[model samples]
Target: MFATPAYAQAAGAAAPTGGMSFLIQMVPLIAIFVIFYFLLIRPQQQRMKKHRAMIDAARKGDQVVTGGGLVGKVTKVDDAFVEVEIAANVRVKVVKATLSDITPAGGARPAND
Candidate 1:
């Protein structure tokens, strides 16, 4: 076997290091997190907080709309559930978390009256 001798050559310049380099690598990730917090996480949290407060304050005679799309009047409100009258003489017990919208006593009346 015949092999040609090869000489060592200088390598290309290496990237710079230190805090600036670290920041340069992390800036995009940090920016993504910040963007997610403001555009997605923070708003969702605020909406959930508002929804929780509204659900916690629900009371009798309030017109409510369930996540299932049922519109009814809240005849009774418990710690974690509510008795909703979807129709005259027809009531169903539903979890409070399933209530998506709660209109105040004066907001609107149930369709069935």
Candidate 2:
């Protein structure tokens, strides 16, 4: 005669009610999303806004560096494109968004110096 004990303790416990349980389980996930928005998304959006402002302020005669690493003087600016003169009589058309940085009013020093 094998007298095995029946594990009936858990069977008598009632199931958790669904009303507040669902909301309670989701609290951590919602908190994580809020944290990510503040730490990651908000900063990225701010950077984008700053970059857009810089791009919008670009003008002819400004020295700018392209995303491709070319430094040139802005010769022309259109709605979506810019013309840059990398060397005397050597110019190229590039997208406005492709510009990464614009030098301040003072000209940049030559790399050799």
Candidate 3:
């Protein structure tokens, strides 16, 4: 009236899974990393590179928007600081890294555009 473990012996007869089995198990993790790299990390890196190029190209007379939402014309540009004139004879010094956007001197494009 009792079942024996003789059938359970068949369970242990299976061979151990090899390296290919381990690799298959890792496939989803690898794919996820690749997806994250392409979808998130890579784009952020490219955006930061483009933003760095733009900051390096900043010069005097360029209209700049700061991180704080202040808009002004760049009167002087230095390696680390920029003198921005927000109003007639009113200027403020800001760190170059704080610049968010830059419009060249001839950027008379319609504001509504």
Global lDDT of each model?
0.92, 0.88, 0.89
Q: Supply the global lDDT for candidate 2.
A: 0.88
lDDT, candidate 2, 14-94, per-residue tens = 768877988999999999999999999999999888888788888889999999999999999999999999999999999
| Candidate 3 residue runs with Cα over 4 Å from true position | 1-15, 108-113
* Model 1 regions more than 4 Å off: 1-9, 108-113
Measured on C-alpha atoms, candidate 3 has an lDDT of: 0.89
**Candidate 3 residues 1-113, lDDT tens each?**
69755644436566658898899889999999999999999999998998888888888999999999999999998889999999999999999998999888899633421
Candidate 2 error regions (>4 Å): 1-10, 107-113
Quote the lDDT for 91 in model 3. Answer: 98
The whole-model C-alpha lDDT of candidate 1 against the native structure comes to: 0.92
Better of 2 and 3 by lDDT: 3
Clashes of 2: 0
Residue-level lDDT of model 1, residues 33-93, one tens digit each, is: 9999999999889888988988999999999999999999999999999999999999999
Q: RMSD of each candidate?
A: 5.4, 5.9, 5.0
